[model samples]
Target: MELNNEVIINNLVKRFDEIVAVNEVSLEVPAGSIFGLLGPNGAGKSTTLRLLCTLLRPDSGTASVAGHDILEEPVNVRECTGVLPEEGSHTLYPSLTSYENLEYFAKLYDVPEEEAKKRIEDLLKFMDLWERRNDPAGELSTGNRQRLALCRALLHNPSVLLLDEPTSSLDPIAAKRVRELILKLAKQYGQTFFINSHNLAEVQRLCDYIAIIDEGKILLSGRTDELRRRLQSKQVFKLRVADNIETAKSIAEGLDFIFDVSIESDSLMLTILDPVSNNSVLIRKLLNANIAIIELAEEEMTLEDLYLQVIKEEEQ
Candidate 1:
């Protein structure tokens, strides 16, 4: 049977006094897909997540998770969805040990006793918290606590997962592991994920599709590569030459398509007007000018680039 869209929002809005925290936001997250909500701080990413998870009721709109209406069937929605809020660590009992926390949630989630025991042990070992399993949750390091919180979120294996800043306090290695685990779950278990994150690189790497939200409004949403291709024409390229870097800069500045030429330590930073058509033109001009080119490459277009451009356009 075809699964319904794991999460859906329509004309979703929320407010806190004079501040409109979420303004008529709408989105659809397909089942078994990794969907990322990307935005700057205070841009309503967390608010949207909170609303979907039934923590906060929408002021003027509706949302659903796992085919259950967040407003009308909040209990059903919560039963089918797992959540890791922005302050995920705080959701754990301060006095409960890491294993105890997961054990407690496992009972609430109704995982069979034997299964919960084995699942808890495996998760602790996978997160490298086995040694600290007996330590009180309040005593664990911030990174360890974050891992523990993630473990609790995954304990019941719900159909939909809503994670806000899942790796916020984690170190580089821990963060990477968390990202890897997300992919693993989505692929092996076919779980749908709706994530809120400001980590652009992480989103770029993990998200199958993404939406950029700002000031409680969505700017754009699409596949990651397609979004990057939108700004391909305005790509930036760096040129390095074995000799006569200034002369190369002059050759580039003479072209109408080239602008903002900066000479940096034997290299030149160029803002190419239409890189698809003009990149080779600049290379030809430099080679013809007797500038022994060391390397000429277009800078990788990142989610940061698309995000900044979208945010800037929205601001204007």
Candidate 2:
């Protein structure tokens, strides 16, 4: 499949005092795709978004948003992108009603009055905040404020949306609704979403591409599924025998490439290195001892596992 590029970062760098907040980071976000940046706190995920949004001037290198250069054409870049910064809800004018808040941003973005009215009403109704549109932003609940901020972000209908923890502080239902909105907007309008989030499940569900960042460096980046498969350096598997489970376990434990072998009655849960090459050897050895292998399958790795494994390997 062909992929068109939306946001391009080239050796981007950012420093704060003695610390390098973003270090020579480079990644391409495909146009009209939901791209996620995953990392622990203080891991440069948010900083990367800030740099792309032109909120922070990079020490070196540059990025382009919707084809506008971050350094040379920041205004153009911002014009083509909408940003829901961290603490996004708090950025709204507390005294203003939700409708007024979006209206103010619409005027700032030069959105036509008629179009902004329709956009604001559509967003508020879709987010189930239509009834609360008249309520003061500060008087609304945190979740309501979050919904309002998202509406404001979308009021201009920019091509690229940069979100920092998009669903933070939302109830479960509210979070789900927000996820639905993101998916709909990305697929329906071809809006490219660049998100920094600690929510692994949300990322797994929403993002077609994801990058793992740690301490200002990208540990991995690719199509979400492809990235996980590439990072499957080692895999955990389960082995079972129709009979002679003990003998099978004994022989399996003696193999150097196999690890974390544990026996529970008829099943053996183990970690294997290079299962493609080593599983045949394992089966051969077990069968030589007259062990009947019933089942041998690898465990599926979850996003949480992928993140923790990458972070742990980085420490090593």
TM-score of 1: 0.87
lDDT of each: 0.87, 0.87
After superposition on all CA atoms, what RMSD does each candidate show versus the true structure?
3.0, 4.6
lDDT tens string, model 1, 169-247?
A: 7888878988988887788789899989887778888998888888899889888788657766676788989999889
**Local accuracy of candidate 2 as per-residue lDDT tens digits, 1-316:** 8777999999999999999999999999999899999887899988999999888999999899999999999999888888899999989999999889989999999999999899999989977899999999999987788878988888888899999998867888888878888898777788999999877777878899998887899888889888656566577888988987778778988999988789877899887888889889999998889888889987766556676777767799
Model 2 deviation from the true structure expressed as Cα RMSD, one decimal place: 4.6
Query: Which residue segments of model 2 deviate by more than 4 Å?
Result: 231-258, 261-304, 311-316
Residue 91 in model 2: shift from native, Å?
1.0
